[model samples]
Target: MNQKKTIILDLTGCKYFDELHERIRIAFDFPKGYGKNWDAFWDFMRTECDAEMVEIVGESTMPKEFLPQLELMHTVLSDLKIENAKYGWNFDYKIIS
Candidate 1:
């Protein structure tokens, strides 16, 4: 079996939702024309991303206004986990302090 790969994304430098999305795209090595939006993120993660685990770091440094977006991102990841399980694709994610 192939070894699992873990990916960590630090949000310390992100001041806006766009930056957060950009970080995700870069970390996942998404396509060059990746759409920087929540829907697009969900689509790519469910269909293309191969990371066994994804960790979110340095979130406290991000802007307060981005709280909603942050919450929704977690929601997306959680939902993806369920779908992955059904397909026999193991995956997990977490936010770290």
Candidate 2:
């Protein structure tokens, strides 16, 4: 059985964009000079980060004002999923409320 790496992002206390970005960057150990933006996030997810699966928790607790940012994250994760599938690698994202 191949066990894939899993990283969980608990958003229980995340409130702002910067906070969310910092938490994710630090959790995944993204390289230095990681721009805290959607484009950079997509790049990292698609080519830099190494985890086979990522789980984001506490979505229901996230601030409503951050909906757009959350959507962007979902989009990036979806793209990564597709990219990984093409390479015969497993990459997945899940959200738990």
Candidate 3:
């Protein structure tokens, strides 16, 4: 039997829809008219890796009344929402064999 205790943090200060949207926009660099690409968005959602799951953990204070922000983060990170490789394109990934 193994027991582990984990402490989670939300440093994005996402406490409302606006904050969440801003975070999403900045995090994923969504176009100004991203709403027009719902199909592409949905397709990416169906096939993508999670950002957090494959990268470093950020520090954020979980703000109350930030359901929208939280949901956006979760959605974008999971394959059910967006593509990870495309999301963090600015970062360079080096493969070691």
The residue-by-residue lDDT of candidate 1 on 8-95, one tens digit each, is 9888769977788889889899997899998999999978898989989988888788889988899999999999999898899988
Backbone clashes in each candidate structure, one number apiece?
0, 0, 4
> What's the CA error at residue 83 for candidate 1, in Å?
0.5
**lDDT values for all models:** 0.88, 0.86, 0.38
- On a 0 to 100 scale, what is the lDDT of residue 35 in model 2? 93
Q: How far is 36's C-alpha from truth in model 3 (Å)?
A: 11
Which of the predicted structures, 2 or 3, would earn the higher TM-score when compared with the native? 2
Provide TM-scores for the models: 0.92, 0.91, 0.39
**lDDT pick, better of 2 and 3:** 2
Query: What are the per-residue Cα lDDT tens digits for candidate 3 across 1-97?
Result: 6332222322444455554444444444455554423344444334432233222123244455554544544553453323445665321221111
Error of 2 at 74 (Å): 0.2
lDDT by residue for model 2 (1-97), tens: 9888999988886898998888788878887688989899888877777898898988788889989989988998998899889989888989877
- Against the true structure, whose TM-score is highest? 1
Candidate achieving higher TM-score, 1 or 2: 1
Model 3 lDDT, residue 15, Cα: 53
